[model samples]
Target: MPLHKIIHINETTTAYFWYITEDVTSLFRAVSLKDTSLFRLEGMKSEEHQRGFLAVRMLLQHLGYTDYDLSYDEAGKPHLSDGKHISISHSHEFSCICISNKLMGIDLEKLKEKTLKIAPRFMEVKHLENLTTSEQIEKATVIWGVKESIFKIKNEKGISFPEHIFEDEFDLKDGKCTAKLHFNNQIENFQIHFYNVEAYIFVCAFPNK
Candidate 1:
């Protein structure tokens, strides 16, 4: 699939997803990559990762941009040339980018048992109580996505998932939630929206205003 889906998060933000079914050669030929990108792609160790990298560029081209329009800062956060905020993530076969006029973060994660098994390390395991096995996996994945999305937004050094980020209690039926980031002796709130995309969970977070 090309652009698999577009979620209009709000008037100012949109998320684009690309389903990666193309081989590395085909994807490489489709998009024009700047020299730096080409070098980075050549250095990748696996074809799966290479395809994901190229799929991100494909999404950019679909949006009337190119690799030249994308750059990253010292903190490894992506920036758009036209001054919009952009966040990118890829897992397994899906590549996605979220663009917003305001600062925000997006994360895509393939649901797996490992995330649920290690949930204790990053979140309050009490929140996972009383759910069926499947529901526990789904909810745990969403909470993990919430934390990852928020981390991408802050991108500050010394932030630990378990120590600084907390997802408020939320039900899977709600499709949204809130989180708190405790760092530097200050508390910051965030609004989160999440969805089930194929076998993956897509999460977006914005700093609470």
Candidate 2:
């Protein structure tokens, strides 16, 4: 299940998904990673983490990119050798990346009961009302991803999900929504697109133009 799907979000951005079905050794052998990436891979404490890291490289290769073309900033945001933007995320069994000419952030979250349980911590509790248990889990997962994607896009300190990011009213079936970030003395808006992929919810956020 390599390169599971490619989503053309717009003319300038695309999202790629990779289902990690290969062993760590096999994945490592398939991609040519830079020395820094190799060092980071070795330091990862879990095999699942290593596989997710390698799967990202495989995705880059699929897009005609290699580890050499990707770099991370001091804030841990990814960058391309070119001026294009990039965001990466991985959940339990899936890893994904989104590349764009515009600033963007993406997150992949596996559906879980824990996210629903902790919904009040990061989101408005009223939004969860009038929904079934399963819908509550899915909706909370999406809201979490929304904040995560926005945080990644800003990559600045002091951005708290509960205190700063707010998801406006939206229905699950809409598959898209809007959010606002009230932080750093400025308010910015975002357009969010989200959908279920396998057992995970994929969310992409782009700052309002």
Candidate 3:
């Protein structure tokens, strides 16, 4: 397989969709086969995450980065040795990355039935009270994406829904929403951009503050 072309959703965000047919070898050649192989092995945990790593690697290469070094800090947040702000997400065959001069976060999740089944775990009573059956599942999915993006941005653990992060009520028609994030004794506002693509809800969050 040839090196699949990179797809850019925007100037700062790019997504690479991988199938088993893609040229994993070429990717390894561009970077280090040893490093790519380690991520490939992680496919056992979740093929989705593995594919995401491949896409992320491709994006990094496009940005003129050949040597990619990743390490986890004491808080378990991923840090790049080069000191760039990076965020990644993968779901099923698709993976996405957001690279920016400032802090950023991105999330992509497969629209699964489980999202609906466990909606209560993440939503607050106020959110539930306003949700109608018609839009409950869709709203819940957006909120999930928001929360995941927050986790990626903060790089810290132990946050609850409704209490820590609050999303403003939004309509699916708008295709986007905003949220207020409360963390680390600071109230930071954020804007969430949502994209409905190929049965998946992709959300990207940036701090407005």
lDDT of each: 0.94, 0.95, 0.66
Alpha-carbon runs more than 4 Å astray in model 3? 1-48, 67-72, 79-83, 125-134
Each candidate: RMSD to true structure? 0.8, 0.8, 4.0
Sorting all predicted structures by lDDT, with the top scorer first, yields 2, 1, 3
Tell me which residue pairs clash in candidate 1: none
Summarize candidate 2's per-residue lDDT along 33-127 as a digit string, tens digits. Answer: 88999999999999999999999999999999999999999999999998899999998889999999999999999999999989999999898
Clashing residue pairs, backbone N/CA/C < 3 A, model 2: none
- Across 135-156, the per-residue lDDT of candidate 3 in tens digits comes to 6666678889998887778766
In model 3, where is the ten-residue run with the lowest total lDDT?
Answer: 15-24
How much does candidate 1 score in TM-score? Answer: 0.98
Q: Please provide, for model 1 over 1-209, each residue's C-alpha lDDT reduced to its tens digit, 9 standing for 90 to 100.
A: 67999999889999999999999999999999999899999999999999999999999999999999999898999999999999999999999999999999999999899989999999999999999988899999999999999999999999999999999999999989999999999999999999999999999999988
TM-score of each: 0.98, 0.98, 0.74
TM-score of 3: 0.74
Clashes of each: 0, 0, 0
